[model samples]
Target: MLKKLLFLFVLAVLCLTFIPQLTKPSSTLVTVFKLTENPAVIVKGAQGSALTVNISFGEKEVEELLGQLTKPYPLLFVDSDWASRFPHLAEEIKKRSVPVALLGVQGQSYETDLNLFAEQLSQFEKIFAARPLWFRTADEEFPSSLLQQLQKAEINALGSTVQWKEGKLPKASKGEIISVSYHSGGRPKISDVKRLMESRTYQSVEDLLFRPTVKTKKIPQ
Candidate 1:
């Protein structure tokens, strides 16, 4: 009897150490960075809710990725830059007029980190016009607002593998340069303009315009 009990305990410990989290996706929104052509992952949650993401984890290539998953979340988390980073994609979602909720993340030890996050979350509240739900630790999981702000304030993008390519540095431009789509791509002399687009300044008004510069060429008539 003693030997059998010890074997069962050992087997349970081994199973716990070796097994992976094979549970299917659940219903929840996630805050994350932008996506690239390489396949992004699905953290998985309930489908068809407002996905107020902080970034687009997988740019436009999410179709194949989403199709492969047993549960494909149709929602776009549009609370912050996650959705707006992809300008065209954001516009498409807006055209559909889908509703989204802004979610914020607080860090662990909110007591030590409350004041700092308060300042950052002030801007988020202005943007969302409501308080955001906070997650204590990235691993802590369950949601709360106090934790959300703390996380955002401390979540620095220092040593991530995601290599951000800054195209044009904003420089002197006419009529308050609206967006990169507002000007041209592949130009190196427009960093400030890039900042404007990145900061969601271009999205304030409805008439933000973009068109290819037309040059008239003289031809024999």
Candidate 2:
């Protein structure tokens, strides 16, 4: 019985030794760099790995800012009036082949707001030649009704920030939210960006965004 017990202990030790450690947290994190009111200054000065940039369409020199985009980074368009204000930016974005997401309703209560949201979506579809699958909002809390409407509109993802949690970099696709880890002030370092770019989780999310949606196979009767 003592020999059997010793053998079991040895086997358990071997198993523990072979098991891999959990290096990352349970959630995946993505990092987003929001362009301040002065995007040109930020873009020109900022240094980091590949990053998704957020731009408000109504900002001045929108074309100039876009023309400066030499590298292919994801772009997030904020404000509902972007299409109406800068109708040609979409064409430029298409030429650049950048991923795009639009700002969505944030806890809108009135029916008029909903109507406006629909109008904005229609405009976006017309401008981009495809519906945007991702959205972001300023509100920390959202209504279920608003969420249902977004889902019904076929939005596949939402974006949030983990900047509040200092020293913690987020992984990609945490539930329905694509959480981003970025510095609140100044630009992130290139080394840090490189790490994010190299992560398997980030690559997985990228592949998911670019992959074509699966269609049901038709069976002949």
Candidate 3:
């Protein structure tokens, strides 16, 4: 009787455990997407052109949307993967011949966000080789130890992040040929901008040829 009771108890426990897993539905893990805000913009000069300087998703629309207008607007583009992903849109942009400039953004004291942005950027990243603008940390809120590890890993084994900022970024080194996206805004003084590109050790060939300012050939009207 004792043996039978023990076996029944064990079987009952096994069934209880197995039944919940088998019958209960799987739970979904919730994930939230954090969107990065591009720089706020202020445009001056030609009111004629529809194109505005920015790093963004909808650039090719310039032609079909308002290319009909007599004034053809062009964008001052930044060199990054975000620009590369849309070959079709880029093709449209090519037709328009929009001005493209590399606008780098480096973090000042916001170390945590900088590193977090880099790692997160790679997952579905659309631009540049690695995260641009190597700041001290990606996430300012993250604990310091983790940040140290990330810094050591990238500096030692992994490659360096982009080290340029379009405007003012503090406490981070700037590199030659800094790459940025359209959304990166607030152009630095011509002299300061020129200095960063010149100071960096090396430049990507494209950047070396055309640093600071690059004029796009006008589209045939």
Candidate 4:
């Protein structure tokens, strides 16, 4: 009986030491998607001439833009900096089922500013009930170290091919990503956005990136 009890205690100690390690998440580098002359990231199954729009601005501007857009809305990059200040916007985004990505606070040093980052992420998840899969910097520029950190966190980094300007609707190409910001000057006019929509179909960033492509079968020629 003494021998059996000692064996059981050893087994329990082994399980306690190894179980948490087995369950811990892996820290691997994830893919970073960005625009380049020779693009490193490609949308594998994209269809047609679809584009994605990412908007980073104030809550009022976002609300106004959301009201103006129809089906296939733009992806909003909510900054942790201002998310707490706009509870109504968060509720509205949740109510509307809008897609979102994390927009890092402008001029943030991710290495040293982790506390703010964590707080913002916590607040965002509290309101949205989930974590975002995508992330981008407010200035559209991401540091290499930050990219690695984001990858370890399992969040993909996204970059824009086109930066929409005030009073001008930049022509977007197929598979291109457009970023609209109030920080550039002011909120983009609804008319410009409408015109862009009329020009071509705009898809959510998630859809454009991950949606499976539908291939047409060629009838016997």
The candidate maximizing lDDT is 4
**Superposed model 4: Cα runs more than 4 Å off:** 1-59, 111-116, 210-221
User: Please, what is the TM-score per model?
Assistant: 0.27, 0.47, 0.24, 0.66
Model 2 residue 102 lDDT?
63
lDDT of 1 by residue, 105-146 (tens): 323434455564455456545554544332112222222334
Clashes of each: 33, 5, 25, 0
* Cα lDDT computed for each candidate against the true fold: 0.32, 0.45, 0.34, 0.61
User: Residue 199 of model 1: what lDDT?
Assistant: 39
Pitting candidate 2 against candidate 4, the one with the higher TM-score is: 4
Error of 3 at 104 (Å): 4.4
In model 4, the worst 10-residue window by lDDT is 212-221
Quote the lDDT for 92 in model 3: 53
lDDT by residue (tens digit), candidate 4, 23-66: 87653322333322221222323433443445445666667777
Q: Write the per-residue lDDT of candidate 3 for residues 1-221, one digit (tens) a residue.
A: 99999999999999999998888755321111111122111111111112223244345442243243222232233324445656565455456554333222233332435454344335323433233222211111223333343344332111122334455642333322233222323333434434443433332322322222222211112
* Candidate 2 residue spans exceeding 4 A from truth: 1-50, 57-72, 78-80, 109-112, 163-221
Model 2: C-alpha RMSD to truth? Answer: 17.7
Any idea what lDDT model 1 has?
0.32
Model 2 scores worst on lDDT over the 10 consecutive residues at: 38-47
Counting only residues 3 or more apart in sequence or on different chains, how many pairs clash (N, Cα, C under 3 Å) in candidate 2? Answer: 5
Q: Which pairs of residues clash in candidate 2, taking residues 3 or more apart in a chain or in different chains?
A: 28-171, 28-172, 29-170, 29-171, 29-172
- Regarding lDDT, does 2 or 4 come out ahead? 4
